[model samples]
Target: MREPVRLEISVAGHAGHVFASREGDGGSVPASGPAVVLIHGIGVSHRYLRRLHRLLAGSVDTYSIDLPGFGATPRPANTLSIAAHARYILSAMEQLGVPEFVLVGHSMGTQFATEAALQAPPGRISNLVLMGPVVDPKRGTVAQQALALGRDCLLHESPSSNALVFTDYLRCGPVWYLKNLRLMMEYPMEQKITGVRAPVLVVRGANDPVADADWSRRLAGLAGRGQLQQVQGTGHVVQHNRALEVRDGILAFAGLGAAAGGEPLPGNPT
Candidate 1:
């Protein structure tokens, strides 16, 4: 596997980080095959998405980004809106010379992805993969989301997953987490998804209490070209425990097939 190159970039005065890896020889991927960009959820960094990035990097260039204020990146001077976060991502992509790519987002990352898609030029994004998207309108309040997340973690998450998540939360700190959590809750995901030009795939863990099956399906249906998939026996952080499944789903949606060879990526279930 290719080792990812870490990057520190400035976008509109805010700094962000990216871990970039590529398929095969590190040559530029053709326009026909768009590179993949991964956006992680709030209060967490690229650590949760590292497995998925490694898997996808075998067939396509992959970028896992740490939006400003999360991960190792410092918080901006002021709280940024969802649109501002999207702009920051777009700026980073521009700096990387990625004219077009697939945007894959998880949880609150989905909101950022959607906003980015809306802001990008018509054909910049080929596909949008939203895994365990958040803030279901019916249960849009912070209390409801907290209750759902707590329930899911207690019932479905593994010990390692909990450890990683909470540790990242500690690094992110309560103030930052709550600030962004409010932004996540206030954003209207269902309505914003309708504006996305790319085909949409909404993925969920079967036991993800935060983004339940019904909400996932609804979010997908709202998009112009949307679909949904559920990974069995996982919770909200599906990409961590079920990385292979999530990777295959993304490849299939992006029309990349199983992998370079016509076989499932190693470590993936046959």
Candidate 2:
């Protein structure tokens, strides 16, 4: 597949970039359907999501964004809150002229994505996907999260995924990452999910140590219209390792085809 076209987006006074592509669209076609906007966690950039982005683009328009202060985007003068990030994200999507789209966020990106869904106008954000969401309240702290992530990286993640993460972290640098670490750890993801009006899909990897099964299920239950789907044999970066499965679940969530099999949540709609 060809590399996605980078679109430099100016949102207010802030600048960010998004890699836009779709099957045969050649970066020229206007997004026609509910597009998929992939948002990465802190430190990492759109590179990790490229494979999954292409896979999803085969059936729907896809845009993987590099948030301000991450990826190629320059660091902001000050650390922005999740709400601020969400606002910029919405503005960028509007600038792109995406009529309606799904918000897919990994790790702490879930915090930003959930905030965006809450801030967006009804119908503008068609759906929300939280993949390996983070800062589980039970273990919400720098040390706790770091230990879990370290264990996950050392024991479970594939070699390629770890390499991608290491390079991205290097690009992010420790100072910029630490600056925002406290905010991510403090964000109440569970409470935020309850405010999202759009359908929420909480996806977790069966082997993920960070967003464990219990936390994922609770997050699903918290949403007004939430569902949980765990991709087997994959870890935190499930989208990269099991792109097809994640695509199926997302497409199904977006009402494009048959329902994807997911872990049952007693209160959440299938």
Candidate 3:
């Protein structure tokens, strides 16, 4: 049901693709309101995000991306850091002519989202959504994180979800995966998020082993303006299986519902 990204964009030589609202894409370019941009975790691409992107795009302009070195995008000559990746994302969105947008990230993508929100110019990023955030400080080592991911795949994720993930992993290959694994393990998500000015929404599946409940709550409490939501009967890929739930949380956080299009929730200050 997902279509190929019709455009390829680059920033500082790092190229990536974006699937967004455009003519012939079933949705027109968003004229107003904050756009939604989805970022995927390592070893995966926009394929897994397609469902959520579709759900969000129906109400507001939305985008799902394939970052450089993953999916169809060509790999970079060298591995880039979290900040460099964030820079690529922001620069590419600017090229898309997006003035302000909401950033939604899953798993390791949370790291990139946090950095992007922090790095964006004041008022550019309206909200930050981190679903199934990763690298719990107490269990931050590769072995522990791998164990949690394996447990999640075996116990929580569905067969179709497993298929999408493993296929993306195969495309990512072990070399590029291992090259960035260190950064994912070392990046302090909790610490980095503390500096983000945008309101943060931390979401995790109640059953997700990768992102412990306590950790998600902690990250929310650390942010200047943050909140946590857990979707029941789901896991690490919460947004995929519980797309509607994710959509509700995002729309509520953005104050889109209960108040017609592009307005703050009644009585709640934006």
On lDDT, the candidate that comes out on top is 2
Candidate 2 C-alpha error for residue 104, in Å: 0.2
The window of 10 residues in a row where model 3 has the poorest summed lDDT is 259-268
Q: For candidate 3, lDDT tens digit of each residue in 123-193?
A: 89999999999889889788999999999999999888899999999999999999988889889887787
Q: After aligning candidate 2 to the native by TM-score, how far in Å is the CA of 141 from where it should be?
A: 1.5
Q: Estimate each model's TM-score.
A: 0.92, 0.96, 0.92
lDDT ranking, best first: 2, 1, 3
Q: Candidate 2: where is the Cα deviation over 4 Å?
A: 264-270
Q: Which scores better on lDDT, 1 or 3?
A: 1
Where model 1 places Cα greater than 4 Å from the true spot, the runs are: 24-32, 259-270
lDDT against the true structure, per candidate, is 0.86, 0.88, 0.84
Per residue, candidate 2 scores C-alpha lDDT tens digits across 111-160 of 89999999999999999999999879888878888888998898888999
Q: Model 2 Cα displacement at 217 (Å)?
A: 0.2
Residue pairs in steric clash, candidate 1? none
